[model samples]
Target chain A: MPPADHSYLTKKVISIGIVSELTGLSERQIRYYEERKLIFPDRTGKGTRKYSFTDVETLVHIANQMEEGVQTTELRRELKRQKSQEEVKRNMLRGQINAQFHKRH
Target chain B: MPPADHSYLTKKVISIGIVSELTGLSERQIRYYEERKLIFPDRTGKGTRKYSFTDVETLVHIANQMEEGVQTTELRRELKRQKSQEEVKRNMLRGQINAQFHKRH
Candidate 1:
């Protein structure tokens, strides 16, 4: 599928039902998970949940981790750690680009 | 502290109390965590809980994750994924070392 924006490619946003199918979990279960605040899916104007490729990836990670008997506390920490790493990467890349732009100017 | 058998380094084992101190979790909580199969720490002959640096790190992850509302099931799945990644790394390294050994022979 084409991306929502012109920048990133291949990965695209999907409906909650599609997410449930990809994650091998029931729609009710997915909604339940969101209510518990495990994941925050985007909402439509009609209040329907919208899933993204990123959300599906996260669900895959959660499913794999649970199979190994990891507890919620540890999982949350790891997710946060991953997010921080992503942020750090973005910041480093941005810094490099900014440096290049200034150098060019 | 010194290494257990000296394969890898920097990390060392310690008592459950030490684990508690390092992870900021109570002894009862730590024991509870183990009983739930969240972490598998070593056991002394007297059945005392012996935690390693790795176990403490896992506890820290659990604590942080729980505070963020991650469910137990999801946490378990994530842990399994991480374990698989580690195992893959080990296998790849082993394969490389074996290749080098065969080349020498």
Candidate 2:
């Protein structure tokens, strides 16, 4: 099983302003990407966007990809594929753990 | 002077349905692109979108760019740049024509 400390699955904790600076992309660009359903950021009670380390990484990656002329649709598909692959891995680990428990009994 | 028959600047005339099929993109995606101001199609009195050959080419170009990981913001910037360039060319042509008229007189 992957460590619980895996950064990508962690919750949002960084502000959008900081995210913009970190990603070196304009805030408008970030918001537009969100509007396009490219990236999902957590919102505060007051409707502020909170990002995570993973989100930062993802944004940077997206920026690089865009510079390379990649399209958003393909990026979205790649992200979905990564998420499903992670889910599969998690399920496989759980099945292995369950099998070990049954053997001990 | 360049021919005025440039396809890029032509008025919209193709239906959204035909544009979708020709571009191999879903109708929703084409609409979403419009919503994002990525592509503009002319509307009919019945609120139908009509695209021109340029719009079709732009959509296909966008799809290719997205596949290459390009962001919409970048694409928007590119489109804007192209427009300004054409505007500059038009102004230059008009200036040259005025100069010729004055010299002939």
Candidate 3:
């Protein structure tokens, strides 16, 4: 089994202002994405939103893709679909690997 | 630079039934994609939709990606985005390559 990596989970969160600065996405756009459930940033005790470096990176990629003539609606679906597809593929592969190990025993 | 390949455009056209058989996507679904302007097939004299080999391949790819957990909306956007992105990238590259060739003269 591959070693678990949760380093991203521990990354610091940035205020909405900082996130917008880093991603070049407007605060309104960020909030809209959150409302659409495109991203789920961390929350502070005072109920402020915080974004990680990965989130910023994802936003950048998303923005770049949008600029490449991809419709925003379609892009959202593609991102969601790719994520789910990989999860299914991974599970199936892991199951096959486990089955092979079991047969070897 | 890659040579232009328009061979797929000349491939045979299949009726809705054949497309469903080849792609495992329902005739309704195939027709629906066309309605959504996702895939544009040819038209018979009787106004029936005629799908080429490339159209069939595209439908299959779209279906497979949908099965992979991508939202249809996002997938469509992604596909469109990727296509346009590549076109832009190609043009940029071609321009640069042409600039270099001109400098040689």
lDDT for model 1 comes to 0.67
Residue A96's lDDT within candidate 2 is: 100
Q: Candidate 2, residues B1-105: lDDT per residue as tens digits?
A: 644653323545556655676689999989988887899887767787767666888999999999999988888889899999999998999999999999999
Looking at candidate 2, what is the lDDT of residue A1?
48
TM-score of 1: 0.41
Error in Å for residue B48 of model 2: 48
Best by lDDT: 2
Which runs in model 3 stand beyond 4 Å of their true positions?
A1-5, A8-12, B1-105
True interface contacts reproduced, per candidate: 0.00, 0.00, 0.00
Candidate 3 CAPRI assessment class: incorrect
Better of 1 and 3 by TM-score: 3
lDDT of each: 0.67, 0.78, 0.73
lDDT of 1 by residue, A1-105 (tens): 432553211122345655665689778766765665667776556776656456666777777787899865677778689899998998999999999999989
Docking class of 1: incorrect
Cα lDDT tens digits for candidate 3, B1-105: 654644534333445665676689998888877776678787766787766667877898889877898766776787789899999998999999999999999
